[model samples]
Target: MDRDARLRKAVLWLKKKDPKLKRIIERVGPCTLTMMGRPYPVLLRAVISQQLSNKAAATMMDRVKEYYGNGKNFPDAKTLAGLSVVKLRKAGLSVAKSETLRRIANAYLDGSISDRKLSKLQDQEVLDLLCGIKGIGPWTAEMVLMFSLDRWDHFSLNDLILRKGIQRNYGIDENSKKEILEFTAGFSPYRTIVCWYLWRDHAAGI
Candidate 1:
């Protein structure tokens, strides 16, 4: 099926899974999630976005593009790997992040982590491969699965904002991690859509 049809189907499945999610869907309306499609750029953006606000990440990425991308396209792995750590740091990356970026570049160049290979792997396999890279963890891997690979079932259980959104929507003081996962399990293959609404509700202060 097409993208819009798939999203609509996901929405319907979510609405059936939980009435709370149904309300959230009514409140939030359509999904606004966008996929960037390229593994290298998407993973690079995810790295830059760590612990930073969206605007800050955008600014930093623009600087990176300007410095290494000839002020136009995103730099390829070979180009980024060739740049000095000092130059990468000047583009607003922390030393660790600079190192991580170079490592990611090297991984891409060495055939350890390519878009083609990742696309053929299952979600858990992909996570294991990505998390093996220094500085990439479960959350980052899930972000790549959802936003880069467009996997519809991925959910970020470690996200504090998602937990808070769940608590607020369910009128609970606290929920165990297991409970949250169990509750969300009802959504199954459409859990990504559920996460989108939860994030939307959190952002809207609902």
Candidate 2:
């Protein structure tokens, strides 16, 4: 139940579930993936990163943070909610993303989305709650679950990098959603670890 124990358990489970993943684990060595920052800031970053490269997203986020608050401190929900849409746009957000950021900030201010509340919800429940917000879809919800909530069982089947990693590593041709889900089911309760490895594989150009 400690961090190291949980990571070890995940690796062992993943190695037992799939040979390809076992090889990946051997190559990757350890699970160092972790969540960073508070939920509000993480969610804000997620919103800003939508449909943009990581560098672009980070640059915009830095500007947005500096415009609203000191760059070292992420703006709280109340602060973000009070900002004008025009001001958010000046930070390089698209109109839609700016609106989404406002909605997320409002949700936090209204107690609709909170770390305490989300911590008590199941993965699917968290997804349902978050996806109900405007401009937050399944992928975004899953990102929150994995990166903000630190839910070990979460996976993003719609992620292109994950799909490519699976296909390339497992030596399969194009796979359907059903196939991917079924295949990944073997990694149940530790699919987040699986995703991390898949992402690493993609990043390594494997």
Candidate 3:
């Protein structure tokens, strides 16, 4: 099925599977989960976003792009790979993040990672490949799968906000991984859409 049809089906399935999540769906309105952009740039921004507020991450990303390329366009892998870690730090990236960006850029530039290849891989394969990079952990890999590759099955248990959202909405303790998994098991294959609603609900303090 096409993306919209699949999302619609996913939403209906979710509404049937979980009443609480159905409430979230109703409160949050439509599932607007979407592929954000190309793998490289999306992954690049994900790396920049770690441990930072959304506003801070966006500001830093814009600064990095402006410093390395045109203010409006994200830099290519060659441009990123060519940048020194120190230069990237000057653009407001932390040292570790700068190093990570360089490693990611090098991974793309050297053909170790490719958007086209990633598009064809199974979810686990994609996660394994991406998480193999030194600084790319499971959470980041999961975000890339959901946002960049348009995969809908991923739900990052590592996301603290998501954990909080679950706790707030479902009254489950955030630290209970097993419980969380069991509670959300029915959301599989459409977990990304469920996640989008949870995020929206959390953002709206619902």
Off by over 4 Å in 1: 171-175
lDDT of 1 by residue, 79-99 (tens): 999988899999999998899
Over 4 Å off, model 3: none
> Where does the lowest 10-residue lDDT sum fall in candidate 3?
183-192
Selected candidate, larger lDDT, 1 vs 3: 3
User: For this target, which candidate reaches the highest lDDT against the unseen true structure?
Assistant: 3
Question: Residue 44 in candidate 3 has what lDDT?
Answer: 89
- Kindly list the per-residue Cα lDDT of model 3 for residues 61-139, writing each as its tens digit: 9998788878976788899889998899898998899999999989998998999999999999999999999999988
**Count of residue pairs whose backbone atoms collide, per candidate:** 0, 0, 0
Candidate 3, number of clashes: 0
Across 1-206, the per-residue lDDT of candidate 2 in tens digits comes to 89989799879878887787888888877888889756677778887888889999989989987889788766788988898889999999998998998899899989998988988899899989998999988888888889888989866987878887878877554357778888778778888889998888667665
Provide the TM-score for each candidate, comma-separated.
Answer: 0.94, 0.94, 0.96
